[model samples]
Target chain A: MELGLVHYLILVAILFCIGILGLIISRNIVKILISIEILLNAVNINFAAFANFGDLDEAKGQVFAIFIMAIAAAEIALGLAILIACYNNRHSIDIEDYTSLKS
Target chain B: MEVLQFLFFGMFALVIVISALGAIFCRNIIHSIVSLVITFLSVSGIFILLNADFLAISQIIIYAVGITILLVFSLMFTTTKDDNKLWLAFAPRTILAFVVAGTLFILLMFNITNKFTDFNINPKSFITKAPKESTIELLKKQGTTPIIGKQLLTKYVLPFEILSILLLGVIIGAAVIAKKDTNEKNRASESA
Candidate 1:
């Protein structure tokens, strides 16, 4: 069968669903971060598929994906740093452990 | 050529799905991270199939290599033992989460597959019949990197500058938080 836009859409849909599953099901905070990355990639696939097959003149989707990557990087860096500090204080990285705000 | 295209798409889809599953479903943190690496690499492969050359390489460099390494380094600092089964706690919450996620996915797929025939409802672009080969070549000639350059400088200049400022703040905040002072926190981290 010839490949069409729908094929790409279906693939993206599956990946997005999987990402959502990971986001919800995973216990580890790091795993949650990875799931968020998966979710972002799914959106990126949607953008690129549209940019390529959609009638747009410019690849705006690719540009947006790049911006998403930059934001994700910054967010992850900040998150990891905060996690380290949390671990330093509580001596644990598990999400269920830390229940304090003033620490 | 069409067959080759189908083959490529199928292969990429398979890789993406399997690796993504491994990344999420794996018991070990290291295994999950490794699976994430494979998932990213295959995503770059799909980008190449879509003729997004710059995106393909950037995805490889930034995601597959850079982010994965950063995550691994962070993992090294924490001492979550592999022998501990505490991470896999099964509860009523897990079941509830799965039910919610499944319902959401089903709803989205039904709406998407049934209602939208063609996503691109852009009237102007829809009016003209641009041949596929020519458009691909046009994208190549116009070049994605330059258009991105133009957009970042012109239309998105404000957000771009603000993001840089935001990133600077993140770096400084992270440094202050992670910095080793001659204190109990540092001592705890050092001994842990």
Candidate 2:
């Protein structure tokens, strides 16, 4: 069967759900960051698919995806630095251990 | 006739799902990072399938190559194999997560069903159109890359400049955070 726009949307939805599951279930801080990447990719898929089929404006989605990648790179750098600092202080990367800072 | 597209979609979906599962279920953080790289590649493939070649290349280069390597290097310094735990502890938070995710999925499916019910499912108009004329030709006709380059320099120049500054700030912030203070007694020396 030919894959249509709906099929792509469904695929994106499923991938997004999996990404969300990863975000919720993974306890390792690094894994959580990776899950966030997955979620961002799911959004990218939707944007590109819409640009391809629903509209002819491919540049819009491509440009947006480029911006998303830049933001993601910045986010990863900042997050990893913070994580490293946390590890330096506590010697543990567990999210559970971060509760001491919780108010 | 369209079996190739279906196969591509199926392969992309499989890679995305398996890599995501690997990222979630793996006990080794490094392994999860590798799986995330795979997931990023698969997503890039999907972008190509959607006819966004530029985004696909950027996704692979930026995400798989740059970010994943940065994460893995950070992981190396942060935790040793001996100190790493096999699995994370589960608690009431897991239950809450399941409930929230399930509810959101149901709501999403409901919305999709309602919205797409009346839409025509035909794929011919979109599929049969040759890619050369539709995208590449149009882009060439419009001097696409140059247009984008000009916009990046002119209209969106502020955001472009701000992004460079933000990246510089992140570099400085990271250096400050990761630098060890020599004034204090180092942990390794104290332990030795």
Candidate 3:
């Protein structure tokens, strides 16, 4: 069957749900970062689909997605660096174990 | 009726889903990074489908090539190679995640169904327009990077400047966090 707009939206929905599940369930910090990427991709899918079906302002959505990717790159860089420092001091990368920053 | 479009869409969806799954489920951090690269590429395909070829190429270059390599390099330095089981305890929280995500999905479906019922399905006409030659051709017609450069320098100058400041802050923060604390510990030892 030919995929319609609804199909695309449904796919995005499922992907968003999966991303949320991964983010909440995964204890690995790197996995959490990956899940966040999945979530961002879901948002990008929605933006592109709406732009395609309803608006000629597709370029705007694409532009915003590019910004998001840039921000994500910055976040991953800073986050992984912090994780490395934490690992050096604590000898582990487990989020549960990083309780010195908690509270 | 269009075979190529159908095939492209199928392939895009398949690659996106598989790569996303691999990114989530992979035990190795490096493998997860690789899967993320694939996911970025698939999203670029979706951008192409939306007639944003410039965005597609930028996405491939920035995400797949630039960011992924940075991630791999940082991971190599930080994490141990042999110790693969890096996950923390996660049993109790997973159930909560499922419940929340399921409820959100149901709510989304309800909203979409209601909205779609009220709206008549009108196939947008602009998408049927003949595809332009390429982004390069359009850029050539419009005098390429000058327009973007002008806009960035004028209209978006504040955000542009702020972005550079943000990058500088990140670099400083990363340096501070990643710095060895041996000197401080030695001071403490001497005092003790």
Top candidate when judged by lDDT against the true structure: 1
Model 2 RMSD in Å is 3.9
Which ten contiguous residues of candidate 3 chain A have the minimum total lDDT? A54-63
User: Which residue pairs come into collision in candidate 1?
Assistant: none
Deviating ranges (above 4 Å) for candidate 1? A101-103, B82-87, B115-134, B140-143, B181-192
Highest TM-score: which candidate? 1
TM-score of 3: 0.80
Q: Which model, 2 or 3, shows the larger DockQ?
A: 2
Better of 1 and 2 by lDDT: 1
Model 1's alpha-carbon lDDT is 0.77
TM-score chain B for all models.
0.80, 0.77, 0.72
Tens digits of per-residue lDDT, candidate 3, B15-80, equal: 888888788778887888888888889888887776556667777887788777767776776677
> How do all models score by TM-score?
0.86, 0.85, 0.80
Model 1, span B1-192: residue lDDT tens:
989988999998999999998998888889999999999998988888776777888898888988888788878887578523434436776787678778877776666556545444232222233336766676668656776778788988888898889889988987897775667767778899
Please write out the lDDT profile of model 3 over residues A45-91, one tens digit for every residue.
77666655554322445445556666777787787788788778787
DockQ values per model: 0.50, 0.54, 0.45
